[model samples]
Target: MKIFNVFPETIFSIGPVHITDTVITTWLVMIAIITISYFATRKLSVKPSFFQEIIEAVFEAIEVTIKDILPVEPWLVIPVLGTLWILIGFSNLAGLIPGLKTPTADLNTTFAFALISFSMTHVIGIATQGLKGYLMHYKEPTWLLLPFHLIAEVTRTIALAVRLFGNMLSGDMITIILLGIVGLLVPVPFSLLHIIIALIQAYIFGVLTLVFIAGGIRTKS
Candidate 1:
């Protein structure tokens, strides 16, 4: 009856070492991304095939979204945003597999992903507008407001990580509970709903990343 038992965990570890089901899943997710992307981009075609077409459509959509959000340099944002969308989108959908759990279902995994985005956001900001300019922006309107701006950034990153982790973990929990009570057939509707939730979470994460990056790149008036 304990659903948690199915998740593997290492008994003990040496210095700087920790292991868990989530770690295994994270590695799998990275490998999956590398494998898919390598093959997807391995051969460029003048006349695209089905896989290439799908990849192109996804990139095109990301490009358009970036253009809408950051008018000045859509090209600059495309690679980052596009890669995030694809990687997160694939990781989210990975839960649908019978034996695999989505990495997003684990708080550690989601937080790590969110932290990377958060760091990149600031790094991009500093790169776009030098350290002095970037730091000065927080004092805009009034120096007293700097603390509030800093708090907002931290709160936003925590919110992003928790939102994704909560949604995916809840979906997985719900599916397991329903399956226990009524077996697989009854869980079909819930699974379908989970699929929708997964896609939405990925889209939301991607859009938020785009917005943060765009804001960072914008100049103060």
Candidate 2:
């Protein structure tokens, strides 16, 4: 293992685009999600299996998170938010696998997520409130705040990306260092803690996305 390798190792090159280990891991995670989802819901009956119950509980939790942020139709946004949670949660937990790196530890993945949320915020804003009303949100309270609002929008997205990258990278690095120092078994507690933190970070990312979208949809009264 390459100890303390901050950058993702390039596995191969397709044309000019280099495919990294992180990308490979992300693809595996997506496939796993799809497989699990298909199997879990494939035999859905009125009497839910334990696995199906767990899946439903997760969806319920995500729905509650969305409803907490916006009173709007939570079902309409569940697919987006639910996918975000699954992707992020899986990415964050990838560190548990010996050879797999967490995609969330890479800026490319987090920034992509942030960019999607940023686009969704404005898109939903324009759809819910007319384009004119959506644009007017920047000038809420006073037009003087337009520049600040615009700057905040871009900066916050960057912040969101960096926040996930930094946290996941730091957590993984620490776990690796501890394991190296005292061996793997000694770091088991830290690994558990990392799992908790990873889930929390995923939840935060999803909630922030929902909140940003909600803000965009609500125009000045």
Candidate 3:
């Protein structure tokens, strides 16, 4: 599956821990999100700054999505969904920076994100419906379907990871091939299309996470 080293490489290691370019890029993404959010919200004024306005709009959008998706209290998922949207968007677009590869293009990174979504869905499910209640949810119609339900959850998570990873990796490969074959000018449109795809993928990933979370919370057979 390795093509032109489009996959992430171990840039360095500390003691027994090996660090890949994906790790470095993800670190930068997290730091950037935190720093921007902190500074933007630090000074609360009647008339907010551009960053503040943008931040508020982002939060509002996620909040609305949560409200629309969930029947009960939707406050709990807002932060998680917002973070996912912003982080994936950042990671997918990170390739735009010279010398830095997009972390989302790495299967390891995407799988980690998918695992987080899987974990959170169950955690939130249990939170919404106590431990015993959530566990018993699988036995809705009958105990016979428990295994099927569990398998579905796992398969969907894998699909989510692969979907994002495949798209980002293909986009990067195409961009690199174009650049190698025809310098930079021709790839501009493709790069722009890549950006649009990045945003769309981010939106799809976030919405899918929210939908999965909602499914866990709703408690159906």
Candidate 4:
């Protein structure tokens, strides 16, 4: 087994863009999600099949969770939240396959996800509340807190990236070590635990994104 601590090995390069195994695995995960999604929604009926029912149940659960957090205009961000959840879910699970590492185990992938969430939070905030209002929010309670608030914005973004990366990397490492030490079948419980952890990480990441967006739009009373 190839043991990579953090950085993924580069498989090849397309001109300036170096494609790593993580990138290939990530693309495969994306393809899997897209293909599954396409077929799942291809046929529609008033009465649903087993497959359709499963899909609908998943969607309903996600929608309910988003609504519980955002409450208002939940539908507006469903696409983003749903996509993030699926992508992260698949990326985390990809590590289970031999010769394929989980993308989330790499800092690059987690940082990219965090950066996107950070950008969207500000964009949504500015769009919902004017630029002046968004800026003024930092000065709330006292003008002295503005610097701390500004620092927080940057720190939280970094924290998001580091938190996911650390959790995913550590989980993958533990699983790999256990599998190596113990025979495969003996480590089945750890494998299952890893799967559960992957789902929880994805859920946490998605919920946090929703929270950031909601915070952006919430008006100071």
Candidate 5:
């Protein structure tokens, strides 16, 4: 019944540093991604299996989405999109496992992802356009709009974190509560719905990253 207390107590600490359940879940997610990718790409086959086909389809879909968003250098977006898709997709699905918590269910994990996306957006922007150009993006069209642009950037990143964290956490919490209330039978439908939501969240996260990256790459007029 103590849901929020699910995180394990810190086993060790250095100064003010502390580790918890959220950190462990994040490592597990990363490991899952590494294992999947290693096996998926390890054996090069002339004829692909069902799993390979599905994996290929996912990569292809990501490629298409990136191209649609960036047009010119879709490849640049692949590493970010691919990693996010795998990590978030698996984390969301982790709810199906008993006694396991989805990493995204933790605000810290979700915020970390959002921060990475935000940092990458600006880094890519600065790399593509010089530092002067990146800074000038906020000062564009009219000087009066500068504050709005700055606020928009911060708002979007917060929105991204909250949207992902809120959805996954709520879904998992609802499923858990339903299981406790009505036992097993009634939770089935909700579980299926959770699956769909998991996939949708992954897609939304990827698309938003693409959008932010694309926006960053745009030249100011």
Candidate 6:
């Protein structure tokens, strides 16, 4: 029997471009993040509000995570990784709302994220170690390993996309099936568990991105 269709349905079109609910939800998520950030930072002062304290804690946590991973100061990479962690976590949890969908459940959305991480990994690598230095890492130990290194990069990016897509897709399907059988109240525990898993996946995705980039920055290993 068919469960959920992996592809999202087209909601509308503009000119020649067709937009899916996935895209719309993603835009909504982006707007929400931007609005919250604007409000959170606009009132900066000597003393922090309660909401500002929570926001500061989130940023501190991201910095600490990056510090634990990359030996560098964590300044350059913080913005990209922190955005990924925040946006992806909120996108995943969007499913908890009654009318909204989780944008990360869509393969296109996750694939786009993986590509961003992949591209930024190389960009930051080059910025840290210059182009020639970054490229030379592929030939480390011997030139014979370069091809294997290339293949690993491509495969890992694909795996990164597929992993998030599979987990969120399966979670959505499970919740739908349970809702069909047991109605609303019974699925509450599972729903909360799903939320926790979503946050975990978001953090894992950011950490994996850092790990991939860390290798590029340091050629020795």
Q: Highest TM-score: which candidate?
A: 2
Which is the leading candidate under lDDT?
Answer: 6
lDDT (Cα, tens digit) per residue for candidate 3, span 1-221: 12337657888999999999889989998898899888887897889888778878878888888799875578777767678889999999988887778899989999999998898788888888888877877886789999999999999999999999999998989888778788867777897898999999998998888788787667743
For each candidate, C-alpha RMSD in Å?
2.7, 1.4, 2.5, 1.7, 2.3, 2.4
lDDT of 5 at 185: 78
lDDT of each: 0.76, 0.86, 0.84, 0.83, 0.79, 0.87
lDDT of 2: 0.86
Order the candidates by TM-score, highest first — what do you get?
2, 6, 4, 3, 5, 1
TM-score, each model? Answer: 0.88, 0.95, 0.91, 0.93, 0.90, 0.94
For candidate 5, give the lDDT of residue 50: 87
lDDT of 5 by residue, 59-122 (tens): 8988887887873476666887677777888888876766566878888878888998898888
Model 2, TM vs. native: 0.95
Error of 2 at 95 (Å): 1.2
Any residue pairs clashing in model 4, and if so which? none
- Expressed as tens digits, the lDDT of each residue in 1-221 for candidate 1 is 12443344664567779777567666777798899889999998999999999989977887887778763567656777677777677777777776666777777777877887898777767776778877777777789997898898899899999999888877788778888888868767776787788888988997897778767566544
lDDT of 6 by residue, 1-221 (tens): 12346788788999899998788878888899999999999998779989989999999999998988885669889988899889999999877777667788899999999999999789888887788888888888889988898899999999999999889888988998888898777678998899899999999899999999888777744
Ranking by lDDT: 6, 2, 3, 4, 5, 1
Worst 10 residues of 2 by lDDT: 1-10
Candidate 4 lDDT by residue in tens digits, 1-221: 24575788899999999999888989999999999999989996889999999999999989999889873577777887788888999898888787788899999999899988888787767766779877767677789997887788888888888888898899888876876887576557887888899899989888888888777566544
> What lDDT is reached at residue 181 by model 2?
86
Model 4 residue runs over 4 Å out of place are 1-5
Q: Backbone collision count in every prediction?
A: 0, 0, 0, 0, 0, 0
